[model samples]
Target: MGSTVNMQKQTDKVNLFETQMTMPPTSEKGSSGNVPEDDPSFNPFGFVTDNPSSRSAIQLPETPAEDGNVGQMLYRTEDKGREFGSTIKSGKLRWFVRETGSKESRRGTVVFLHGAPTQSFSYRTVMSEMSEFGFHCYAPDWIGFGFSDKPQPGYGFNYTEKEYHEAFDKLLDTLEINSPFFLVVQGFLVGTYGLTWALKNPSKIEKIAILNTPLTVSSPVPGLFKQLRIPLFGEFTCQNAILAERFIEGGSPYVLKNEKADVYRLPYLSSGGPGFALLETAKKINFGDTLGQIANGFSSGSWDKPTLLAWGIADKYLSQSIAEEFEKQNPQNVKLQLIEGAGHLPQEDWPEKVVAALRSFF
Candidate 1:
């Protein structure tokens, strides 16, 4: 918690109504043929032809700096209040920030890390709700899966636990944010980024919330994940276009809504998509080691921070036993909360339950 602050000054606002009167129409509907030379619409002002020799001024919008550092562009939402920012110092890393309410009304900040095949857009609906709850939410789109820059082959798409930890530190520093808040993680990202943040800055973290996330490999991984971990086959499969199509088809069952399957698959359709990143993640991050460290930390009874587990009962990739095992191992540190009628993407399936659980924990 911190002191309340007022809203900052409003930025640029373009007037489309005023500009339309001076601008000439470029084309008309159902006009298939080229315009006649004498037509008024044809080079009416001769601006395009006259400006051919003059270099047009490229107008780049000004992005607000935090701590004197300018954030790279990833994407922007319709509302303009939410924007995605990325950085590529050592590697590609992206984050989504919704700077809507006044600083004084910001109850807390929640940093969300998305899983594979999904980006910050996946949390758009949830972010709206959280923002109303007085939280300045930040959700990062891990490299290779969003508007963030995609690294070429042999350049690694996966983020190691240590790398994510450092990126989070830089993100916070650049944002000039220093406050106790909650960490919300999902899917494989939970292991890479979430666990790293929890371990590195336990004192700063106020609470931990996980949904359908696997911290440990309690059961054998699904064949898809296992296949992605294989050496040559993994690389070949990840880079193959057909495999991405197949993955999209297979992943439909794990999402809450049917339409979401396509949304989740959008990133993989591009070259070097989520499949490539997934393969890299398996190669770089030591899943077993991370899970073991988490288990050890929780079992040692040293962590006093409140932990909440909200797992989708229908999760195809992860099982219920994993949650039970985590609870059994760290009964004193965790509060197991079940989410029914949800699959791998519980936040999409059960946003209410997820928010309710976080409220209780925080």
Candidate 2:
């Protein structure tokens, strides 16, 4: 009888162990018994979903508690875009312009044009550094971006390449920037447009420096642009407040520090304008045509102006070979300086290295 009872108990213990192992995961006792959606520790699977309760760049808390958070106030100035900038009337539109150097700048004027989904904010440090060197630096929040006016896509501003070119020209005229200026262009869409603009008016540009922008026909179109082409999805994707910062992080080797991330995220949080503007611009651009224009425009004999390829070797988008090919095409004038430890947006990734290259080249 004792043996039989002991055997039964052993079987019961085995059954209990199996039962515990096979049981479904659940939330804490106070909550519903469904599998916990967040907190990997609460769930047996040890994986958490992208829910708000989790901390990530996408779900960054807008307000971090601090007595005198200079980082917090950084966004209030629209990422220092307002403090270092002013609004100017250009073609009946107001452009939020960042001018670093004095009117009587000793070095020549330098215009920095940023790519899509990003604004002139990327150039804040670069511009500041460049200005100190006596180069009159101007970085504008392209209309519908940053602190600039975001007009609806109809009457005067259509967000087309032509309209952008026109608006830019008018902005230059309004700023009275007539002399040939050194140009630093980077990123996508509008960045490529800047190159095309240079091609169209070679006489207006003294020298050009290109960062990690797509230059070849084979350059792949990023998913952001592709998603923006979809009807409903595009609209939804564009509205993401964290889009710009995410894009930068996705492309770069280093994660953006929260302080810097806040600067990039500020514009999108303020209004829907930057997102819509980017969406319109993305959908309207013909990548094939634009890439062809850039490839051919800057190829061997076609491009004469001295050019510098301050390429970020770690760029997730364009590879080093792209720069190598372009340099090979124009071995004489097109100089290539591969920035190590940097990614797609080299200037933002390592401005000191970029400034070093610029100081040497320009």
Q: Pick the lDDT winner.
A: 2
lDDT of 2: 0.77
Q: For candidate 2, what is the total of clashing residue pairs?
A: 0
Number of clashes found in candidate 1: 2
lDDT of 2 by residue, 28-96 (tens): 322523333454334332211111111222222322222123333434545344547888888789998
TM-score of each: 0.67, 0.80
TM-score result, candidate 1: 0.67
Q: Alpha-carbon error at 1 in model 2, in Å?
A: 56
lDDT of each: 0.56, 0.77
RMSD of each: 14.5, 13.1
Kindly report which residue stretches of model 2 are placed more than 4 angstroms away from their true locations once superposed.
Answer: 1-83
Kindly give the stretch of ten consecutive residues in candidate 2 with the minimal lDDT sum.
Answer: 5-14
Residue-wise C-alpha lDDT for candidate 1, range 76-195, written one tens digit per residue: 111222244433343244544433333465577787777664566556666767777887777766655555555653664345666657766776676665887778787664334676
